[model samples]
Target: MKPAELRNLGIGAVLVALAAIFPLVNDGYWLSIATTAMMYIALSTSWSLFSGPTHLIALSTAAFFGIGGYLVGTGMSDYDTSFWSMAILAPLVATAVALLIGLATLRLSGVYFVIFTLGLAEMIRNLVSWVQNNFLGSRGLYVLTDFTEAHIYWMLLGVSVVVFLFGWWINRSRLGFALKIIGNDEEVARHVGINTAWSKVILFMSTGFFAALIGAIVAPRYSYIEPNVVFSPQLSFLVVIMALLGGTHRLWGPLVGVIPFTLAWEAISVSFPNSTTLFLGLSFLIIVYVLPDGFTGLLEKFTRRAAK
Candidate 1:
């Protein structure tokens, strides 16, 4: 297998191990942390498709993921949408929405794109509020009245697997090559006749799909969905921090980030009780400023040098 293929397989193995082991080692506290981490993995991995590969740092990833949460939430409560069906449909719907977002904003790159996506997230959040207030007659929606944490765990695991595999697939394909080019230089990529617009659309759409899939799972897990939780500025920050801190495009980066960050978050919350968010903020800031490629990138570099 090529290096990318090997990397992908290694990641898959790690995820499988995590899924199998989490239930055994995880209590309510740990399980909650693990599921949140998995959600981060899904969100971050997808964002990496655009931000890491295409160098199009989209800030609106939260919008797509939040939309996913609402998608399955509304489907379940108001529309009688089955969990299984929304599980299948949320990603697709999110992708379609992302396609429009990508196209409308494809002309921008780097920080510009990032800002645009931020605006998009805000817009979506407001839209969610309006819809809920007018249609649902509330500011949030809820799902499961009663369900097992294990069910949430399994569903999160399965969706995380899907997103991880999708990232692996894209990282090895023609589109991936196109994205690498876009990452390096959009002008050069355009000169090379790559359909920059289409690639952008596809990248956003792909990421949006997984983001939404995670959302579907998220709504059910909480049995509630609120605009802020779904589309919060903090949501975007968390995923971006995870991706950037974990080596962005590397196969194991998301998992690396999700695992440690989740653990730290839980630990800090338990120990400090009152300063959990403060702890996460400080950790991410330190990680970004000191080791932007994340711990996984450092590990990968050491591994490669050792191999040499």
Candidate 2:
């Protein structure tokens, strides 16, 4: 294989080993931080899968994630379902919702898609909130599971690995090529016999499914979740910012983006508490102005200079 391909394979193998080994060695604070970081990595990477290739800025992460959490919450509380089944059911449920939304909105281009996705997430949030207030007495949902922190860490790690591999596969596949063409110009892609609509729908559904899966796994980790927390638009925005700030074009960019930002975020949250969001927002603005291509682009520039 070529040197670059070999390097990527080596790196992937190392990452997989590290993820598998982490939970075994650490259990307290470090495990919690690592688990949260892994969750963000999965989330950002999943967002990048479709957004990077298609140039469609999606804002529906919370919609699917919140839905999955609620599904698991209700299923366990009301119907006596198991965590194992909820994992499968959550993604399936999100995929179905994604398919309908994708079919309706994927045909629209540019800002319209973004607006629809953003609006859809908010709409769902409000609907769920209303349901909680009237029918469920505004008590919100409590996710109960017997899984330990190690189990949760492993689950999130597994999802992160799958998301990474899926991103790598897409980067090398026919779908990737079509997406590149679509990203450049959807009309041109369609004229060239690529089914852009269906391609986009597939991407949408895949992202929705995995985002939901992450939510399902993460929900039980949290003691309680209301619509405001689970369906927060800020969650959608955070992943988008993480992916963009990391560089969305490359498969590894989001993962790179998640690590440093997550660490920094944790530090800032501890130090300033109330100022965490303020600092994060400011940093994002700086990143947009200074590192348009993100840290990956910065790394590439340095590597080329070193080669020279």
Candidate 3:
């Protein structure tokens, strides 16, 4: 590995080590806040892994996430299956769904792709609700488990670590090079012999897998999961905003964005619960108008000036 990569890895390790100490030192509301932050950290990072390189603006995260939550909910509540078993199966199911979606939709680009992805969660949510109401005789399922907030936090942190490492590896691999080329120009990438569609599908599947895994991990926290709650469209927008706010160019950028944003969001949810949607919209506007390149981009500018 290059010196820069090694340095990044070392910094990431230290940050993870410090984060691990949070639960040990604090079990109050802050611990819960930290856990939520870690969840977004994982989600935004995983989202960036594909969207950053491909510039696809996928809005289907909630679909995969809800799938995982519903799987765990149904497995534990209806089938009497173990939480771990559901957790294990969730990603596989999500990956399969992603493959199907990717194959069908990856060819579309620009606003059309974005529109399809945005609609996917709503479509899936309505379908799930219908299935539950008509066939299952319920609007939701219970996911009772002994896992506490701390356990969930740790699990999310572990997933975040793995994702970061995986992203780091991808950044240095031939696949990453292909993605960069594709992002630059898909036509050029095709002309140059890159299988752009397959490359995108692979990354899309990865994002789906991680999102599902995370949803499964957090299912117990919800306890009673309804399709509407699990498949909330707000979650998708939040992940996209967080990833973009941090600057998706770097593997660690999303983490930088997630921490501050999560804390602010928590405060907003507590202080002005009814106005969150308004605030979320405002935040996106600010990100687009003022910090289009994100905090990482701003930092790079400062670094360049200092160097000069």
Candidate 4:
């Protein structure tokens, strides 16, 4: 393995060790906070896996997430399936949906791509809402909530680690090279014999599968699943902001962005309550102007200057 890979393994080992022990000393409140942070990390990194390399702006995070949650919720309620069974099934469903959507929309780029993705998510959300209200009853579905907070925390941690490792693997693989080429110039990539569309479709489906898996496993932590809550646009936007704030070009950028911002989000939400969204919006705008490449890029610049 390369030195960078070794370093990443060492760092990941330390983080896994620390996360494993966190529930031992932390209270339920802290454990919940940590779990939320881990969930955001997983979501953002999974999102970065596709959007970072391809430069496609997707707002379907909540769509996949909500679909996974609903799959679990409905499966358990309608068929009495176990959590593990639903967890395995949700990702498959998400992958199918992503394949269809990616194939349809991969041809669109730039702002048009963004709008279509966002529109697709909203359409799904509304369809889900209508179904629940008409057939499934207006009330939200209840989840099996027997698992302890520690178990949920560990699950979240595991998902985060898996997502992170996948990002690292892709960034170092030949697929990453192809993505960079496509991102730079899709026409050139095609001229050079790269199958850009299929590459994007594969990535889109892969990321969707993981994002759905995370949501599937995490769904049971909450006692209830509602379309409006799970499919909120804000949830999608949060992942985008997290990835952007961390730096999209590097595998580790989302992790770096998620940690501090998750903590700050918790604090800001508590302090401002009503105005928390406003503050977050302003913060994102400021970061775009000040650190266009994100915190990871800034750190790289600082390290180079220090070395000089």
How does each model score on lDDT? Answer: 0.76, 0.86, 0.91, 0.84
Each model's backbone clash number: 1, 0, 0, 0
Per-residue lDDT over 189-275 for candidate 4, one digit per residue giving the tens place of the 0 to 100 score:
999999888888888898789878888878888768877777777888889998899999887798888888889889988888898
Residue-wise lDDT of candidate 2 within 1-308, one digit each (tens)?
Answer: 78999898898999789888988898999999998888889998999999987878899999999888877887777577887798789999999999998888888766778888887778998887787678866375667778888898899988988888887788788998899999998889999999998998998899999999999999888758677777777778878878888998888899888888888888988988999678868877877799888889899999999999
Runs off by more than 4 Å, candidate 2: 1-7, 136-140
Candidate 3, after superposition: displacement of residue 12 in Å? 1.5
Give residue 141's error in model 4 in angstroms: 0.8
Better of 1 and 3 by lDDT: 3
Identify the candidate with maximal lDDT.
3
Model 1: lDDT of residue 62: 76
lDDT (Cα, 0-100) at 291 in candidate 4: 85
lDDT string for model 1 (144-224, tens) is 745567667777777777777777678779988898888888889999999988887887787788777777777767677
lDDT of 4: 0.84
**If scored against the real structure, what TM-score would every candidate get?**
0.87, 0.94, 0.97, 0.95
lDDT value for model 1: 0.76
TM-score of 3: 0.97
Question: Model 3: per-residue lDDT, tens digit, 56-175?
Answer: 898989999999999999998888999999999999999999999888888766666688888888999899888888888855589888888899999999999999888988988999
Residue 171 miss distance in model 2 (angstroms): 1.9
